[model samples]
Target chain A: MKFLKIIFLISITFSLYAGEYAVVVNKKNKIDKISKKQLKNIFLKKRHFIDNQKIVAINVSANMPLRMKFEKSILQMSREKLNSFWTKQHFHGISPPLTQSSTNSVKLFVKNVDGAMGYLPKNLIDDSIKVIYEF
Target chain B: MSFKLKTILLVLSVSLIPYAVIMILMGSTLKKEYTENTLQEMQTQLQLNVDRIEQYLKTLNRDMHFMSRMDVMNDIYSKDLDKRISYLLMEKKKDLEIEGDFYLFDKNYKIIASSNKNILSDSKKINKFIDVEIISGFDNTKIGNLILDFSLKNFTKFFSNTKSRNYYIIVDKQKTLFLEKKFSNALKVQMPLKNKTNIEIVLQEDKEVFQNILKEYEAWFYTTLFVGALLISLIALYFSNRLIKPIISLSKAANIITNKKDYSYQVDVNSNDEIGKLSHSFNTMITSMSNVLDELKAESENKIKLLQEQSKNEMLEELSSNLSKYLSPQLYASIFSGEQSATLSSKRKKLTVFFSDIVDFTDTTDTMESEDLSELLNDYLNDMTQVALKHGATVDKYIGDSIMLFFGDPESKGVKEDAISCVIMALEMQEHMNILHKRWINKGFTKPFKVRMGIHTGYCTVGNFGSENRMEYTIIGSTVNLASRIESSAIPGEIFISEETQILIRDSFETKEELKITPKGFKRDISLFSVKNENKKTNKIILNEKGLSIVYEPDLQDATTKKDLKKTLEEFITKLSV
Candidate 1:
């Protein structure tokens, strides 16, 4: 058991230096390098139109690590806070972003849809999607 | 009931029966419609809520799956990733709009991160695993469990349209999950949740909605029925009055006519209906009755007048019969035969008048009993009146025991014959006095009652000579006075005649004595003569012997009567000699 404890501690210490995530948009998008607050606004549906183009925000599943990192780093909100915020937005006829099951699907949605934005690990990022921000 | 009331009730009932039945049917139908519509509306609302809940659940599942696949899940093995996991959980809670905590646990069930920080210290076991999702690493290896405790509050807000109502999601008889508000009593509607096992949503409905709808419909039903009944009753009353008023008035008029028995009264019939015609017929009956009564009254009056005339005729006949004894036969006959009128007018005519009376009647009455005296006087007067009527003299009147008679007035032979008749009547009356005297002697009256009479013939006023009320058919003139004067001067048992009467009867009668009678009303003395009839019975021989006197009528020229008389005389003389 002591050995197992030493192993668990080493594994936890190694996970602390995990790699960063990236926020990507469609390759055809005109603007890049969006602010963290603007990304948060996009996900919350507060700023649907930017640069005269309708934006479509996408999200990963609730239990996904990349989505958790994106919520903490870019949106800077917890799961409970987003739930409450979207519920309030629903009263004003607004909706949260669309969701995907995997990082590859998120990348594919961003590649296919105009003004689409999503987050994924840096390794999963491809030429089809343009990385707007990294958090 | 009165006619108007009956009529109104009849009409009202006729309309009200069908209307009430239709209203009842309509009310029931409306209530059925309300119930059906309410059920359909509740069903639609329940379905919408069910759709919303399913959609929310789907979103939660999709989001949890997406989060599990993120590259940030690699940080799960790192000791410094607890804050990051906690923040991610909190974000998920906010995004899902839940009032519940979220938890990230390691493979060993040890809590790693949670949205509610206080949940880490509590050793209490979880009430349930509402949504337990797997959290995976970047290599698709299982990392931990992601749990979400969903609050029913937001779903309750979605279905909060019903207040004072309750909803429960009952998993068993005892375990119930309240969706909106907690309630003890409820109507249960079972709803199945999508992609769920052995779980159902129970929708509860309050009875208040149905009750309110029924109350509104009831109000409308009663109001419409009441207004319809009132309007129909008013119309019935109006029409009934129009139909019944004339009949009532006609009945009143009929009552008046019967009670008063006045046929002149007329019924006021304004309309030309059957009642008006009846009134006209009644008026005709009264008129006919009144006319018949008038005719009966006139006929009765005529009968009464005729009876009165017949009775008056009977009375006059009786009076005239009694008066005929006072008038002379000829005068009575002439007046009754319409030959003479009873006007008080006198005419100058030659008449032979006669007067007669009892001589010393006062003296005889003083000596005799009154009854015997009246008897003897009636006997003498009866015989003298017989002799006067036998000579055709009109006996005018009798003043006590005296008589005045005239001839040649109502009926006459001639002036000369009238004088002769008057003289003969006077002479016969005097001769009748002798017979009456003998009759009185046999009646035990010693004194003889003698009568004196006189006759005259001259121009005299005769006929009805008195006033209109007491006119008498009598002679009144110098001739009448002269006859009265002659009667006064004559001796008892004698008749005197004036010169005119004596000359008229000189060839028929013998004069016994002559005298001058100057009456008080006469201007000159009237020569009167005591008269006897030439056919008087003076041939009788009277012989007195002893105390007896005998009277004999001898027929000497007849041999048979002379022989018989001689034989009787011889027997009487021989008896006297012996």
Candidate 2:
């Protein structure tokens, strides 16, 4: 049991250090991966087409840990900074990406919709969606 | 009924019946027209409200479609994260004064942005009144939907709620909105929204409210009709009385004339109508009748006066006929024929007068009862008067048992003829006295009257002579007194004549000388002569003894009397022989 406990602790520590999340899209999308800049531009409504297909970006609810990680790693902005940016973009007739209450709903939305994109934990990603980017 | 009452009834019927009928018909027609017109006006107003609500709903649908097509709707691709589309929706809600909110939803059924921010989530879905899909501006792709939450208050600008009239919404023909209670007895108008067919707008009006307004109109109409009827009745009464007055007065006048039977009463004429003419004619008739009655009364009085005069004349004629019994026949004839007047007047003409007496009448009457003496004297004078009247002598008067007569005054022969009639009348009177003596013997009167007669012929005054009040128609001269004295000197049962009378009768009679004596009224002694019939038949036989006396006249007896006298004499002879 001690050995089993030690192995469980090591696995926990490795998972903490290497807990990766992936940006995903519908399996029918032509793209295998996405750049962080392209993701930022698509989510911010600046770039609308990718590989000749229109892009739709989605997010989990605010205050979600994965949403915070996505903002920190991909959007490269704090929550306050993103909110201020969207507030400014509202004046320009621009909107932020779509949001859902849970990561599962974000994943489901991205898997069913063409040119749809959302972020999820790598473990939760399945064959129904393609991994376009990782963090 | 009285004429006035009849006239009043006629007027009321003539005026009021038609008036009441017209009023009832007009009232009913007006009531129907008023109700229909009021309902039509209400329907028109409700239709106007319905049109306004339909216009409002159409505009709302158009506004939702316009907003969905706008560039701001691109924010739906970002799930309206910047709140741009929601801001526009909030502005439109404010401008429309809606009680609902607007929402934006993505393809995941997530609420992207909403005017009500708390509803912005994937778990919240709104029931929409208006919905439009958002398309991408760059790729022409549907990304999301813009929706309006259904609110009954959204139609408040088009509808104003009142006690009787209210507006409500019916969703899906099942749920009623914006209504406090459901009404069963209400008039309703409904129209569905053109954009949302399941939503309906309804307008309701209370039927009882309209009915109350109609009832008020009915009350006003009936009151006016009643007032009009009252006015017509009063006018009828006034005209009826005015028309009947003259006829009433005429009837009253006719009644008075019949009751009192006074034709003098006249009706008063007050107008130139037919009744006035009738009164005038009635007065004229009464006047004429009164005049006729007066004329009848005067004619009756005149007839009565004529009848009274006739009765008086008849009475006077009867009185004069009774007076004629006391006068001589000659004098009565002369007076009735108007030959002599009844006054003390005498005329001197030659009149022959004669006188006769019952010899020793006083001695004979003193020995008998007065009744028997009067009977015997009337019998002797009646015989003397009969002989004198037969010889045409007028009997003047009777003094006791004497008779005085005259001739040649009222109806005269010659003086010689008058004197001869007097002597003859005296001889006949003497002869009639014997018959009177025989009648007296049959009456058992032993003492019979012996009458003596005297005659004279001389001039005497004759006419009515005496005082004016007492008149006798007789001669009044010495010749009358001499004749009376001559009658006294004659022997019983003898005829005596004066010398003048003997001279006038000597040719027709036999005469013998008699004693001459001077009369008291004569100046010389009057020579007297005894006169007898010249052809006298002596058929009388008489016998007298100490106890028996008999006398008879054969020439004066009929056969039966002769037989009775012979039988009596033979019986007496036989008794004397015995």
Candidate 3:
């Protein structure tokens, strides 16, 4: 019981200090914002298009702290649960979102692809991409 | 060369040489064609393998291009965060069964996605066996390049290496891969990969392997040629023997015939070919020659028989000529003419018989040398015979120095003419004795011969009289005896004729009555006459006898020679009187 209390206390402390992240697309995208549910659907491959255009979702690598924070804050799932969900979705001919090793590559990916979107730290946002959602 | 050897050579030349040449030509042609066809097959196989390699490369290039164009390539912008492109590349590499890796490079030439995980994120160059541009699907722009690190082992699935055939890769005409063995005298084929220009597929087929097969075929072909040559030689021998056998026998027979001079030799005929015909013709020629020789022998024998007959006839002619001296010419002619038969037979005919005697020939021969006497006697008889023959009298016989003759027996003019011929012959014989007496005295024989002749014509038996083996052609009976008696009574140099002969000869000669005598068998005395030549005159008288020879020529003698002759005659008369 004491080991579980210490793990809960450390998680809450990390959540208080976590930096804000935004889901961004190329600057040429018309969309200004996205609902959290829509972002979830896009990342999970449940929704394939946005605003009548095919959408490509991007993610950070699995070992990234930002990826863990995003999964905790928005996916509301653990790493094991997300991995099992994507594994199940693979049978349905649906794939998880593309991943990048760093926030810089994630930003570069969203900046280059027109219908591509990816989450990044807010401080790393640049003029090459547009923020469609912030958290 | 002998006929058999010649024939064998002919057959071998005709049959074997051309056959051997054709066999060699065919064997060489077959080997050449087979080798060409084998090379062609090898080339076809190489081309098929090359085609498969090209097709595989095309498919690989297209697959690479298709993968590069996939929507999943959009993830290259995200650096394949989901590793989807790399997974696809690995799957293609496995599907191609290539011995190389597939890698996706970003714009900076950094390997972002690769089938080989160890090479992930490695920086690489654009040089590769095959490469394709990675285009972002949403932006429609080039993002990176997909490349393959190709290995020569990848062509192993298309072609494999064997003892006789080998496959390899040549890169840029310098770099050789896969099999590195150097091949000498091999068939080499190379083609560049369509997608990889620097890479070539090289196929080599070792010619030594095909050469080995060709050598085996050549050995077999030569063996067959040897066997064929042997068979041809055997056939040549058999045919030469068959063809030359008759000719050899013919030669042998010819030799035998030449040496032995025989024409009965023949050759055997066994076939209906030309040789058989030649043998038959040879036999026919031999038979014809034999027949001709036989005819020549027969003709020659006939010629010899004719020659012998001719020689016998010549001998007979010579013998008859010799015998003619012993016979009267008329009798010899009559016998030769087939008119007279030599047999004991007689005919009664009026024959004028003549008789002559050398008076005192015996007494003269006793006084003279036998040689001189015989010479004188032969001279006298020869002269007498010539005279008698001139008158056509047949001489009957000679008893010592006496000769008996007749006419009208073998051939006669009637009895009157015969008697006249006989008396004339007797007168001629007395006259010829005068010539003999002169010849004898000149030859140193002083004694001369005196001949007395008598003739009579009467019916007498005149014919061949004697034994069958020994016969005389003569006249016999009283006419012959009376003629002898008349001859004895004749003066030494006188001719006396009986009355019958006188009557017959009176017309041809002058006759005077000499005397009359009754012969031993006569009943009355017959008057004898002396015959004288009518045209001759008595100019001289010659009397020659034994111990008495008087020749008085009144006109030729001078008075002194006449007195000397008269003295010799008177002395001879005194010697005769004593």
Candidate 4:
């Protein structure tokens, strides 16, 4: 019973923190501003190029509020609809956006890698990361 | 395998395999065809018609959706929210011209607007609306529900607008209490139920027409399969019977052959195909085999019978030969001539055996004419043999001129008596041949011949000898040898008997003592006797008139070993008187 209570508390805690994600870009890159539509379009694989540079996209985990917001602003569909769509896309040899676990990992990835794009929470964002789009 | 068993198996399998396979295959195919024709096609067509009905329902549903979104309902909505709701019933009717009655309910499910004037009409159909509203709540984009009454009363009023297609609408959201047919006003009713209901759409012309077509197709499919199966079965059965007719007859013939163990049964010959050829071959083979078997059986029986008869004949011949050869001629010849003869059994009686041969009768006959010499010797032999044979002396053999005679078989009249008879017979023969000498003198024949006979008696196996093939009925043993030696040492007409014979005849003869004669197969002289009659002195006068009573020197009997005793006696008188 105690273990169950702990599990229940952990799920609530994850749910509370679910929507808190920050989009991260390389800190050294000068070009910065991006629209939510462009972010959504890039991550959903609907548009390939952004601001004349090929866009790189990433994802939050399944059922997370950030993934929901990402779907509404980008794919413009429910998660079930998105799943069915990706099922079709995978059949056609296309894969969805790359995902990462923690915002700190996204920040560290953007800092060390070129052409890498990802998201984390605002508090986890730092000088090594630049936010291109935030919701 | 026996030829018959192999043939039966071959024929049965040959006939049965294809037939069984064809029948089983036909039965299975017939069943398969029956199921496909009856159910599978119906299921496929049923799914097809169901899909058409679903399509129709979906299209009507879409059209009703478009009607719900029309401007006219909105125009009333754009007006008042209260008094407008009541007048809304009439106006809503005009607005939704395609339906029987149109009604509106607030989000709280209270009747707000209606197209029926029975102001209680909304309550009257409240059940239908309440059921529809409950289902509309969970839908995200859906606003309100709509119901269309397609009862014929209203349907006939708007029939001109929708006359292109024939359809029926049923509102089952509220339970149906009654239905009245427009054409006949005949009502059908059902048990009512509380709201939480269903809707049904019925198409009369197109659906019924299609249903009739489907029903007809079902009927046609079933009837066709039945007819086809029946016809095919009839045709197949007819052909099968026709095909098996010859086989049945053949089977009957085969059964007969098996039961009877006779190969004579044959199948009927018809065509020149496989079956016909088989029948013909069967007939030919069976007939030939039957003939062969019959002939073989007859031949074997004949051979057995013949062998049995041949064996029996051989046995008979052997039996006859045994009977003929094993019986002593002493008895046989006498018995053959029907003579009353007896065998003398001398258990302790003394007897003698005799054997003699001519010195060289073969050399004499070589110089003489064979026929003349034989006649001359036969005339001499006749008298000597008769005397010996007549008095019960067995004339055992003649070796040319010499006579070997024995007493004591074919009846022994006592050995002493036989000796006495033999001496008297010799004297009488000498007298009798003087007459032949005179007759031969008148005919001027050659000099009268002399022949000698020897007699001895002792123990001998005076019986038959040799095999069934060649037999000699005579005596055998040692006593026969002594008599032969004594006779061969004697002169013609001289009486020479062994010491055994001398002892037997002492009373009959005025005996002379034994004179030993040698070089006649004896180491010492053997006693021989001379018989002198009481008129011995006048014997020369009788001898002169007839011939001489010649004293036969014992040595002359040795020379004329096989000469007749009678002729030897006749010539002896002339020699003795000299």
Query: Could you give candidate 3's per-residue lDDT for residues B220-325 as a string of tens digits?
Result: 9999999999999998999899888888898888898899989987777898998789889989999999999999999999999988988887897788888877
Against the native complex, each candidate's DockQ, computed on alpha carbons, is 0.02, 0.03, 0.20, 0.01
lDDT (CA) for every model shown?
0.72, 0.76, 0.81, 0.55
- Is model 1 an incorrect, acceptable, medium or high docking prediction? incorrect
TM-score of decoy 3:
0.66
For candidate 1, what's the RMSD? 19.5
Off by over 4 Å in 2: A1-135, B1-3, B107-109, B120-125, B135-142, B161-215, B260-578
Q: Which tens-of-lDDT digit does each residue in A24-79 have in candidate 2?
A: 88888999867779998888788988989878777777888988888887789887
Give the root-mean-square deviation of each candidate in angstroms.
19.5, 18.6, 15.2, 27.8
Candidate number of the best lDDT = 3
Which ten contiguous residues of candidate 3 chain A have the minimum total lDDT? A10-19
Clashing pairs in model 2?
none
Best by DockQ: 3
Error of 4 at B436 (Å): 11
Better candidate by lDDT, 3 or 4: 3
Candidate 1: misplaced stretches above 4 Å?
Answer: A1-135, B1-344, B348-354, B358-366, B369-371, B374-395, B407-459, B463-474, B479-578
| Stronger candidate by DockQ (1 vs 2) | 2
Positional deviation of residue A112's Cα in model 1 after best superposition, in angstroms: 28
Better of 1 and 3 by DockQ: 3
> Pairing residues by index, what is the TM-score of model 1?
0.39
